[model samples]
Target: MDPTLQELLDGIGPRLRRIRQDRRLRLEDVAEATGLSVSTLSRLESGKRRPTLDLLLPLAGVYRLALDHLIGAPPTGDPRAHLTPHRADTRTRLDAVVVPLTTYPGRLQVFKQILGPTSEPPVLVTHHGHAWFYVLAGRVRLLLGDTERLLQPGDTADFDAGEPHWFGPANDRPAEILHLFGPHGDRFTQPD
Candidate 1:
């Protein structure tokens, strides 16, 4: 086996023993819960026996931990999604940066949008989704289903994307907002 791999495997015994001790469990207790013999459990913990899935799985269940946790798996890398900010429009001075906030592919997506001065008028368009926007800085102009509203900093709006809606900087100034969109008409409900 490769040295790194061997080192990882060697550490498993000590980790297993530590976790068992941390839980104030003895080898006999673990054996009783995992249906493993006390001697087998002890040998595994003492590195006399190599750890295997058959052994680790039952022990993990008894310890209420994931298999990786039992083995002390190293992190693959940072779990956070890398934020890539992109301009919404390049031809116009109406600068807008859209940064995706969600990592997984799903019906509900989130974005942090920053809009600069817009010389053109707001063009309303309709689509199939539910949208919620929270203004974080400056002011925003929201046109939804024939109604128009000016949202200031800290203001929020939730509406069906199927309705004709448009939003941008309220005036010739910059604005930042958090936008949550559900492509399949998913609604955002506050947890009870």
Candidate 2:
């Protein structure tokens, strides 16, 4: 076996364990989701069984990760991140496109968002998290409870997500923003 291949294979076991632990998933939970037995998962994580495509495919789905990232493949020296934008408004009728900026499990998630005016009145929602929004282009209107504010370029707002809040373009035109959402008990670090 090539030395590089051996090294890559050796690292997969630890990476699997680390990803599972980082996502706060238990072995039983993984087994149930991936349809792989707990003992098999344990052996795979312990490097007793060599990883095959069949084993990794389901794990990748459950973890919401690309195969390359899952196995820690060497980077292709590409500076650009081939990000896929996903819809943010699944139930609500808000028109927005969200490109995920970070993918670390069980941690703060960041996104670049583009939003359009809403036809219906904005719906305020509450969730267990903290969010910070920064306007990158155009204008964004933020409605939190009874308070309403229009944010322009370079403007920022950080608030408790527990408060009823919804935000989108202030007018008919589109707006762009950099959004950061941190889950419950997420502590943000500041550079010294």
Candidate 3:
């Protein structure tokens, strides 16, 4: 086995023992719950036995944790933001998410907005915040009540959510934009 891989596997045994002790559960109790032999559990926890799916599955259930959480795997180098995306409507490819949900109010909430060509008529929604958006690549057609304009790449726009508005891709193409939503009472204003 590779040195790093061997070290990683070796560390899990001690972690398992620590978690079991922290939970104040005895080997016999865990064995009875998981239907695994107490001796086998002890050997596995003591690093005398190599960990396998058979051992890990029952152990994860006993500890009330996912297999990945129990093993402590390293994170993948994904460039995508950590935001959990949600679709507003299938007709309009409006993908959005609130960043750092527990963050303090008034701080900027970042979002990556992707709108498809079919996304239109903006279905103006009311919310308690202001928003500023910058087009990253494609064009975003903004409909702020009577005002309508096409924002091209590198263009930015800001507006109050209280104002009825709608937005979608211009020229029937997909659009990507970065939005910074502000807290209540902070009205977004465009640079004149």
lDDT, candidates in the order shown: 0.87, 0.89, 0.77
lDDT of 3 by residue, 24-47 (tens): 999998999899999999999899
Quick one: best lDDT, which candidate?
2
What TM-score, over all chains together, does every model reach?
A: 0.56, 0.56, 0.51
Ranking by lDDT: 2, 1, 3
Segments in model 2 whose C-alpha atoms lie over 4 Å from true places: 1-81, 185-192
Residue 2 C-alpha lDDT in model 3: 88
Instruction: For candidate 1, write residues 1-192 as lDDT tens digits.
Output: 889889889999998999999999988899899899999998998899999999999998999998877898875655676689988863333579999887656668889999987788777788888999899999998888779999999999999988888888988889999999998899988899
Give the lowest summed-lDDT range of ten residues in model 2. 75-84
- Each candidate structure's count of clashing pairs: 0, 0, 0
Specify the poorest-scoring 10-residue window by lDDT in model 3.
95-104
Q: Check candidate 3 and list the clashing pairs.
A: none
Clashes of 1: 0
Which has the higher TM-score value, candidate number 2 or candidate number 3?
2
Better of 2 and 3 by lDDT: 2
